[model samples]
Target: MLGNSLASSPLATLGLAKCFHHSAGEFATYTNVLPLGLNSSHHGLTGGVGTSRNKWIVVCSTTQVETSSEDPKTWEECKEALSCFDFSVEEKDKILGKAFGHIHSPYWTEERAKESPKVETLNQILEFLRSLGLSDEDLHKVVKKFPEVLGCSLEEEMKPNIGILENQWGITGKSLRNLLLRNPKVLGFNVDCKGDCAAQCTRCWVRF
Candidate 1:
């Protein structure tokens, strides 16, 4: 039965959004992100000298954040982090909005929201995905699908799961990349339990 669910959707057995939740302590370590001291004036296209014209700009809207508290300030950091990607302003807004909503829902209290992952962590997640050979379009789709991924611990969660997919299931290169796009939720699974999870998925695929 578990294998059947994995064959249908790799994350269905784990419960969709529940897989992403972790103890507040897991997020506490990331709360000290150095603020960029950003303000309404900082909103605009950002490109360093000699940088390629194709690079996307960090476009911050004055209206994106409504307060000066730590929670809202985290949104500013998120906007800065997303600037490193190739997404357009509109795309960035959508991604940022989704992330903002996810972290602010009833599931996340004011304290947890304030302790959310910072700019540096968010960039690390994006860079890791890019290293996996995801194009800009694919990256956008994954982030939009699983905004909670921004809060995941790279060393603890993402890498281990990818390792299981490669070493255990032999899913690599293009096949691995396509699988991730189809089921970005797989990244949220706790690494310690992922081996058994992937094993079940393997059995289901073999049965088919």
Candidate 2:
């Protein structure tokens, strides 16, 4: 009689609705006897008025999103992947975190990590930038800000563009360094469109 009264009450259904949306971790608590098919998985409820009186049910969904699978690889895998590049543990940590400015990007996946571009090519680019007078610390900062620079063409792209900024625009040495720190994206700008590229760089420079 008590179970039938509770199950048929509209107030009990309202209370159940309130419980469902309470919070992520909390769950509704109730006790009742009902027909076997009275509960609904979609409606998130169980129990009903039935003549059987011998069965009870509890229904809820336990689905949860998995975030760990999104991570490309472990720290050890990152170190091993970059093994041929002469990076220390600390340096590897920085490189992994700042490679694409956000380690969570799809580029950090295991497949992409395995297919990383040639270490020798990246070394040449790093060396050229170092030759341009950026210290190791400054180079890391630049790479952190714009990791795509590692994949840029040195002869046809980076050199000509950097030369124009320093020579044509008179942004050399300290000024150039300041400009890079202010907007590292300029390093990846297309030098083929020198006018547009220089205009964008100038605008960004003026803003800072």
Candidate 3:
């Protein structure tokens, strides 16, 4: 599902609106997100950057307490921890989002280098994209043009495609190809906001 959050950089969101040619911020629903503090706090999720890196990002105020308490627990535990009165609903939403975003099946979390690519399935997906009128040249152009800044390979980032492994990289898959075809812009990726937004962006919050 697409979100209307201005959390994305202006250029990307604007370009997306222009591409789809519709205004949709109010129509889009906010995903689950929660704020959390550093590992020293009681409510923060545990794990190292190397573990969760870029898989999910958290936005929180500096005054908030960060904790690793939720890190060691399962999703059920994390869900409960989010209700503690020490934090507000808005704050809890942010932290929960990060953990949820990063919580993949143990299979996906393994070192990507060691995993085998789903070559056969990827080929069929690639064929599907081609049938949709996306040319080989276009696919190459789009994937290469985007650089998939957010994923190790576009396929690794999402289970739906193999195109991410391509782009001239040794990877391969087709599920990603379809996903990219759907949201080609995201293939370009973005850097983390580091939980701070110094650049003002028209009070992007709903402030509900």
Candidate 4:
């Protein structure tokens, strides 16, 4: 039920990775994502600032004939799309494992992995979390309990919320990291809204 609760929460909704299944066009296992007249270096999923929006877009190369399938029509297609990333088998297993097994439901199958956070993105998030001084086990626990945190933006979401916890609620250093390990979902609250992160954190802290 933790997985289901996370999947439906606003924090998860804000940070959860989106898959290409929502697209109106046909689905292809290896759809070319290049922008019109742009080379691969200048196309989709680029890391450089101003190169592209921080969202994923599925596009077919101009040279390829469009397929007729409206979407990922089968489990195989969904698996292919999700596994097309550059990550290795071990990494894929980790992500998908946490997604499917952690939740103890068929809710997030391969279809969900296709749209879940990229391995690289998840690794970046993990790296930032590590800097917070959490042990490997605690770090894994945080992610396993709240896998949706993988989709959060380092600057916009994670750091800002952590900042609110520290600045407003005085949850600094080890105490903060420990708090997160206890309940990573606390990071999902929008500290920028209403009374902001502090007020929200206050409410949660008292209950925590």
Tell me the number of clashing residue pairs for each predicted model: 0, 0, 24, 2
Give me the runs in candidate 4 sitting further than 4 Å from their true place: 1-116, 191-208
Measured on C-alpha atoms, candidate 3 has an lDDT of 0.33
On TM-score, the leading prediction is 1
Q: What are the models' TM-scores?
A: 0.50, 0.42, 0.21, 0.42
In candidate 4, what are the lDDT values of residues 1-208, reduced to their tens digit?
A: 9999987653342222332232334333322222222233333232111112222223322111112233322212322433434443334334443443322323222333234334455556767887888767776577657755664567776787788788988998889888998878676544334433444442243434
Per-residue lDDT tens digits of candidate 1, residues 168-196?
98999999999889888677565243334
**In terms of TM-score, how similar is model 2 to the real structure?**
0.42
Question: Following a full C-alpha superposition, what root-mean-square deviation does model 2 have from the true structure?
Answer: 17.4
- The 10-residue segment of model 4 with minimum total lDDT is 46-55
Cα lDDT of all candidates, in order?
Answer: 0.52, 0.48, 0.33, 0.46
Ranked by lDDT, the better of candidates 2 and 4 is 2
Q: After superposition, how far is residue 27 of candidate 2 from its true place, in Å?
A: 53
Q: Which stretches of candidate 1 lie above 4 Å from their native place?
A: 1-74, 84-114, 191-208
